[model samples]
Target: MLAKVLLLCCACAAALAAPGVYDAVGYAAPAYAAPAYAHAIAAPAVAHYAAPAYAAPVVKAVAAPVVHAEPIDPNPAYSFSYGVSDPHTGDQKDAAETLQNGVVHGSYSLVEPDGHLRRVTYTADKINGFNAVVERTGAAHGAAVAVAPVAKVVAPAPVAVAAPVARYTLPVAGHPWG
Candidate 1:
């Protein structure tokens, strides 16, 4: 057994001392030197596409039969305002406009997503920055409202009646216990 173990150890040592697999296939150190390891990554190159320059279309003006038409007034007599409502949350926006002696008076209201309402009433003009009043009204978010408790009116207690007594005497037959 000792001789067999010694032979096995010698064989393993000889195999390990031989040349590696890469050397046997002629794949020794590369002819060109390898580059050093870099810690930082290189920035990637990107190209952005833009629309090509376009020439404006030429509009050919036509000479029509000369006709005189009424000129348009820049400023109108009446004032008007409109607003759009949000569909998903059931919120609404509203505005009203009125011309008061050439001054524009407008009132605006916006219903918020959380059921709160905001209002602004303003006298707006180019000369003066909007003179406005703002108001907000609604229950605060996540705030609970207190409810008053109702007083309980208990009905009167029912009267108790006495149970009927049964009386029937048995005829004859003496016994130790009744």
Candidate 2:
């Protein structure tokens, strides 16, 4: 095995030192110079082909016909109201909005986390970007108190005792062959 490994290493070193490979460091000299020819060999002449002259077809963009679309009503009037009340969790919220004459007026109310009711009235228009009035009604009860859970104690069931079992062994006798 050792001899084989040494031979492989030697072969690899010879291959790496060959000419034209790893010559950037100028360590290995070229193996041999290229042979010179008596006369220079000329390349065969190939006929040149010129692409046929082509002019892109003239394309004129005709102006699309002017179309006048029906204008929409900018000052539309609309009203909507929505509310949600969950008695189990005591969550309540409602909102109402109305848009008239390019003006939006809306109001929303919700139960706050502190048990207080918060209401906001807002109005928006071109002159006044947005105006809102917030009002908090009812006293703040604060966070709800958490009650510790109680563990119930259960009595263990009675276990019935099993009767004792009896075992008997017969005396060994001499074998008939013996």
Candidate 3:
């Protein structure tokens, strides 16, 4: 459709530009002889196009070295420590753990919920659940004595509350929303 419209517009432009086509009313168009056909001096034919070939890149593949990891320690005695800083409040925490005779024990110090520094001592094992003891202490970098964990069972206060009613809105207008 577009090509047809373009061809039509070109033909109309050519007709308007022709000398004989621009005629005055009541006057016949001037006779202009058609152009005589003449053969053009021949041009040599264009040679066939050929693309230049490219060589493939050469790559050398290397075999990875055979790696041997260190053997696992059979003895159950080991110690480790870690420390981290609180990005927002600039608080610091340091914790360490020691495994001796298959019993695991650790201590950690951190800022308490009340913004006071506190230290926690704990012992844990697979069979027995972790038992911890917390004590208010100096801040990080302050001298603190190592305290042994005591198996103290403190009972919590019991409380009761009534059940809730009318806490939620019901579905409306045939939709599961309110």
Q: State each candidate's clash count.
A: 0, 0, 0
**Comparing 1 and 3 on lDDT, the stronger one:** 3
Give me the runs in candidate 1 sitting further than 4 Å from their true place.
1-64, 67-69, 72-75, 81-88, 141-178
In the range 1-178, model 1's lDDT, one tens digit per residue, is 9999999999988886664534444444324434455765554343333344579999999999999888976665686888887688676898888876557888989876566789999897777867999999987565455669999999999999999999999898988796
TM-score for candidate 2: 0.40
Relative to the unseen true structure, what is the C-alpha lDDT of residue 47 in candidate 2, on a scale of 0 to 100? Answer: 33
TM-score of 3: 0.33
TM-scores, one per candidate: 0.35, 0.40, 0.33
Candidate order by lDDT, highest to lowest? 2, 3, 1
Number of the top lDDT candidate: 2
lDDT of each: 0.74, 0.83, 0.76
Arrange candidates by TM-score, descending.
Answer: 2, 1, 3
Candidate 3's displacement at residue 112, Å, is 2.7
lDDT of 3 by residue, 77-139 (tens): 989999989779767799999998677999999875455688899999877879999999655
